[model samples]
Target: MTLQPKNMLNRLLKSLLVSFVCIIVLSIIINLTAIKLPILTEASYERYLILFLYLIVMIFYVSLLFDQLYLSQKAKGISLFFYLFIMTGSLQLLESLVAQINVQPKAIVDVIVYTLVITSFTVLIFRYYGKGAESYTKRIKNYFSHQHISKWLLKCIYAIFLLFIAHYLINSMLTPFIEPYYNGRYTNILKMSHHAGDVKYVSMLTHALVMVVGFQPLFALWKGSKTSLLFWFGFPLFIILAFQPFIFNVHWPLGFRFPLFIEETLIMYIHAIILVHLFYVPDETHKEEELVKSKLSLSNW
Candidate 1:
C-alpha cells in the first residue's frame, strides 16, 4: 500500500489528538479514584507530557502499520483495541513483576485495576463493533487465509526466535554493568529475574516471544518493502524510539546518562535493522500473483 504524505500527516495528527484526549480522560478518572499509577504519580509533569507525546507518535506509527495490512474497517477497529489491550497488559505485567520485588501494595492494586479497565473496554468495544462471536471468528480466519500466510511469513517465526535469543544475551551481559551503577533502582531488566529461580528465564523468554509474535503482522506487511530506502531509515529510527520509554525510566548518573541513552538506542536500532534486512524479504507468492495478473491482462489485449 502506498502511503501518501498528506494522509499520513492527517493520521498522525488524529492519533496525537486521540491519545491526548484519552490520557486526559483516563488521568481524570484515576485522580477521582485516587489510585496511584507508577509514572503518573512519581514522574514529573514534564516527564509525563513527554511520555504522552511519545505514546502519540508510537500509536500513530502502529496505526499506519495496521492500515498497511488492509483489513476490514471492523477488523481494523478491533485491531487497535487489541493493540492497546496487549500493550497496556504487558506494561502492567512488568509493573506487577517489579512490585513483587519491592512489595508495593499500591502498584499491585494499580495493575489489577488497570487490567480490569482495559479488559472491560476491550469487551465493550469489541461487542459494539463485532457482528457476532461466530462472525468474529470467521473474520479472523478470513484475514489469516492462505494469501496472507506464505512461506516467507512462516520464516519470520524462526527469525523472531533468533532475534529474541540475541536480545536475551545482549541484555544479560549489558544489564549487570548498568545495574551496579544505578544500584538496581531504574533498570527493570535487572529486577525482572532477580530472585525468581527459573522465573527469570521464563519471563524473559515469554516477553520476547510475545513481542515478536505480536508484531508479526506488521513484519509481514512490511516484508515486501524491505529494500525501500524509507524502510531502511525509518525502521531503525522506530527501534530507537521504542527504547526511549525504557531509557527514560532508568535513573542514571548525570555523567553516564546521556551516553547510556545513546548507546542503548544505537544498539537496539542496529539490532533490529540488521535482523530485518537479513531475514525479512518480499513474499514470493505475492510477487507471483502480481506477475500472473499482469500477464493475464497482456494476453487479453
Candidate 2:
C-alpha cells in the first residue's frame, strides 16, 4: 500500500496523541496499583513524556515499515502491543540486573500478567488473521535472499566487533581527560571507581547490540526500496531514537560527560549506517533479478 505524505503525517499524529493518552492512563494505573517499577517513581513528567514519544515512534516504525508481514489491522495491533511489552519488559529486566535496581514481587507479578495477556492476544490475532496468510518468515526470506542474508549477517557481526574495539579504545583514551569530571559527579555518590571492568564491557556490548538490532526494521524497509516512505521516515527517526535516551537522560547504565556521550552515540550511528549500507547497497545483478520478479508478479496480477 502506498503511504502518501498526508497519510503518513496523520498516522504519526494519531500515534502521538494515542501514546500521550496511554501514558497518562498508564501512570494513573501504576499509581493506583502502587507497583514499584524502575524509573517510574523517580522520573519527572518530562521524562515520562519522552518515554511515551519513544514508544509511539517504535510503534510507527514497526507498523508502517513491516506492513506486508501482517495480514490485517488486528495482526498489526497485536504485534505492536507485543513489541511494546517485550521492549519495556526487556529494559526493566536488564536495568534490574545490571543497575541493581530493586523491583518488588508485586511488580514482577504485574509484568507476568501483562505478558500473558499480550501473548494471548497475539495467539488470537494469529489464529484469525494468519490463517492461509503469508508467514513473516517467508516474507523475510523472499525479501532478503539467502545469499544476501548470509553476507549481511557477517557484515553486521564484523561491524559490531569493530564497534566494541572502538568503544574500548575511545574510552581508554578519554579516561584521563573525562575521569575527573565523572568522578566528581558520581564516584563518591555511587561509591564506585571510574576504572573499566566487566560491568563496563558488558554494558557497552548490551548498548551496541540494542542499538543495532532495534533499527533492523528500518534497515529492512530501506533495503526493500530506498524510495519507500518508510525509509525516508525511518532514516532520520533512527538517528533521533538513538540520541533520545541521552537527550532525555532516560536511562544510562553508566555515567559520563557530554564528550563521552557524543562519542559513544556517534559510534552507534556509524554502526547502524554500516549495517544499512552493507545490507541495502544495490548491485546490478540483484536489481535485474528484482526487476524481473516485479514484472512477473505484475503480469500474474
Candidate 3:
C-alpha cells in the first residue's frame, strides 16, 4: 500500500490541529470539573487519563508509521484503527490483571468502555478502503534550502523540552523501583509469581522504555529526519541509564523529587509532542521539492 498522496496532506494536517485543540479543551474541562465528577476522583482519574492519552498517542504514531511504510491511505487508516483496538484491548486486559492482583474492581469499567469505542472504530476502517502496498519516501537533499532561523530554533527548542520531560519521567518512576530492589525482600519477591507490587513497577519501566526509545524514534523518522543518526542512538543510551533500577540500586540518589502528579502530565505532553511532530513532518524531504519543481515547470510552460 502506498502512502496517501500530497493532496491528502492538508486534510491530515487540519485533522491533527483540531484534534490537539480538542484534547487541550478536554483537559481543561476535566481539571475544572474534577471535584464534581464521581467517576473522576483525583488518583484514579489521573491513571485513567494517562492510559487514555497513551492510547490516542499510540494511534497517531502507528498510523503515521503505517502511512510511511505502506504508502497507502487505506492501509494507514486500517493500521491505525487496528492498533487502537489492540491497545484498548490490552488496557482492558491490564485492568483484569490489576483486578486479579488487588481483588478489587476499581475503575476497570471505565477502561472497558474506552476499549469498546476503539474496537468500533476499527470495524469502520476495515469496511471501505482501497489502496496499493508499496514503500514511499521523500528524498530532500537540502533541508537548508529555505532557511528560517526562528522557526528552526523554535522546533529544536520544543524537541529539547520533550527530551527533558522524558528524562524527568524516567527518573521519577525508576527511583522508587530501585529502592525496592536493594531491600531484603527483593530476591524473594522476584522469585514469587504473585508480587503485584513488583509487577507494576516492572511493567511501567518496560513500557517507558518502549514509549521513549522505540516509539519516539519512529516519530522522529516520520518528521523527515535521519532517525538513526540523530535520535535512535541517543535515545537508547538514555533508556539504558533510566533502566538502572532493574540492575543495581545501592547508589547515591539523583535527587529526582519531581512531583508524581506533574510527571504523569508531562509524559502525556511529551507523547503528544512526539506524535504531532511525526505526523506534521513528512519523512520525504523530496516530497515538497518535487511539488515545487512541478509548479515551476507549469509556470515555464
- For the record, the alpha-carbon RMSD of candidate 2 to the native fold, in angstroms, is 8.0
Q: For model 1, what is the error of residue 184's alpha carbon versus the real structure, in angstroms, after optimal superposition?
A: 6.7
- Candidate 2 lDDT tens digits, 43-104: 47866867677646754554454453444455455554544444445433433333223345
Lowest lDDT block of 10, candidate 1: 125-134
Q: In model 1, which runs have C-alpha deviations exceeding 4 angstroms?
A: 1-5, 34-36, 42-44, 91-161, 182-197, 219-224, 227-241, 246-301
Each model's Cα RMSD? 7.9, 8.0, 15.0
- Which pairs of residues have clashing backbones in candidate 1? none
- Model 2 TM-score? 0.59
Q: Tens digit of lDDT per residue, candidate 1, span 1-301?
A: 4668996777777766655665665577677987765547554777668657765665566555554555556655656555554455553354234222333546556655644443343333223332322344544444355455665466556656665566556655555444454455645433444465465455555655555566445444443455452464344344323354354454435444444444445434554564555444355645665567669989999
lDDT of 3 at 201: 51
lDDT value for model 1: 0.51
Model 3 Cα lDDT, one tens digit per residue, 91-132: 223322321222123334433443344434433332323354
lDDT of each: 0.51, 0.51, 0.39
Candidates' TM-scores? Answer: 0.60, 0.59, 0.32
